[model samples]
Target: MQFRYLGRSGLKISEITYGNWLTHGSQVENDIATQCVRAALDAGITTFDTADAYANTKAETVLGDALAGERRESLEIFTKVYFPTGPAGPNDSGLSRKHILESINGSLTRLKTDYVDLYQAHRYDFETPLEETMQAFADVVRQGKALYIGVSEWTAEQLREAHALAVDLGVQLISNQPQYSMLWRVIEPEVVPTSKELGIGQIVWSPIAQGVLTGKYAPGQPLPEGSRATDEKGGADMISRFMNDRVLTAVQELKPVASDLGLSMAQLAVAWVLQNDNVSAAIIGASKPEQVHDNAGASGVKLDADVLKRIDEALGDLPESDASQTRSPQGRPS
Candidate 1:
């Protein structure tokens, strides 16, 4: 597996990394999660991304349990704060100093690690002052609870402000985690260029567009059984949005390109994202070990310039006119 320096930082992470969003604790059982993590590690994925709020804090526990013993030091662990993990009121969430301190400690205890390689703010906390948040992050770094800090789903202005604050406070903000995929190109106009200019790498999530680009869903077909979209609690809206004719047609049209290039639709979608120099890694979520193995193979496949152009043409121009419109959770332009 190929690796890249995370932004301008010396930390090198595998180009294809493993992420547990809704899979580890919510969907897959402990043994299944362990198998998936082991598969990813065997395939040379050294970075594992999770969030304290994922699965009500069970994800990190599962990950820690899976990585227990000999494999701990071989992996780089990244977890996020800034999300509510309980009903402790407003202070229980956001980037407040109280929350940051408590959340990091909670994550550390759950992960069974003294320090996290990367700690990220799950999203912008508009209610809190930027200095308060950055200073809290700096304090964590100083205390050795976190090595590098990042922000996720932040706008360009927010990212710049955070980076400036980190610089002034003498803390290095390493990367930004955002949803960026073939079907979701909103980040291209602002977030991508800003990250490139500011020397912050982007470890993008949903690189396969929540499996919309995987070609598993077809137009006018019943939802596949046991798919994430079929989950009773999750991905209902994702299924609806992706099952539309327009998205299905796009996926269908893109299939031959992937087939011709000797890759799965998921691999082609991931390779397309990794083609960007600003992207340090693509955080792939998998329900099964084989899914992680398939995505890991994407690290070696490079899309030619012509194929990229064709993809752009097929996907059409990015929806540049809708920057002000906030996207839905599925990464759809509003």
Candidate 2:
């Protein structure tokens, strides 16, 4: 696996990192999670990304359990805050000072590590003061509870403010996690350029557009068995949006590109996102060990200029509006 610097920080993370989102504590059982993590490690994936809200906090525990014994130090663990982990009472969520302090300690306990390599705020907390949240993150870095800090799903302006605050306070805001894929290129116009300008790396999630770019769900086809669409989770609506004929046709056109390059559709999709120098890493989610192995293969594929042009022509114009405000089922940017 190829390692790149995370943003402008001294820390370096593998280009292909493992992420626990809908899988770890949800679709995957303990044995499967263990195998998946072991497969990722065997493939040289040192970075593992998780969030407190994933699987109602079970994701972190399962991931931590998988990294137990002598394997912990061999990995760089990242998790996010700002999501409700319990009753949605006051101080239960958001980036308030109370929530930030409590959430970090809670995450540390569940992750089985005293310090997270990177701690990210899951999203912008409109209710909390920016300075308060920034200061809270800085305090944790100073206390050694988190080695680095980042933000997710934040606008360009918010990211800039956070970076400036970190610099002024002598803290490092190393990276920003966002969703960037062929099916969703909204971040390219603003977030991507701003991150590059500010010297922050982009650790993008959902690089495959939640399987839409894999060419699996063709138009009019029933949801595949055991797929997120068929599961009782909230992804069915998102799946419905991606099942449109236009999206499927676009994916079909890209199949030839992947075939020509001797790569799977998923690999091609991931490689396309990593083509941007601003992207530090692409976080891939897997329910099985084979999926992890398959994603890791993306590291070997590179999309040349011609291939990139073809992809862009096929995808056409992606809507730049934020999907989160509409209660989109898939993971939002970050």
lDDT of each: 0.86, 0.85
Q: Write the per-residue lDDT of candidate 2 for residues 208-283, one digit (tens) a residue.
A: 8788888887777776788767766655655566667878877888898889899999999999889989999999
* True lDDT of residue 178, candidate 1: 82
Q: Which run of 10 residues does model 1 get worst, by summed lDDT? A: 325-334
Candidate 1 lDDT, 1-334, residue by residue in tens:
9999999999999999899998889888889999999999999999999999888799999999988884556778999987778664657778889999999999999999999999998888877888999999999999999999998988888889999999999999989998878877778888878888889999999888788889898888887888877876566655454566777777788888998999999999999999989999999988899999998989967788899978877767531224343231332111
lDDT of 1 at 276: 87
Positional deviation of residue 12's Cα in model 2 after best superposition, in angstroms:
0.4
- Least well predicted 10-residue stretch by lDDT in candidate 2: 325-334
Model 2, residue 91: displacement in angstroms? 1.1
For every model shown, the clashing-pair count is 0, 2
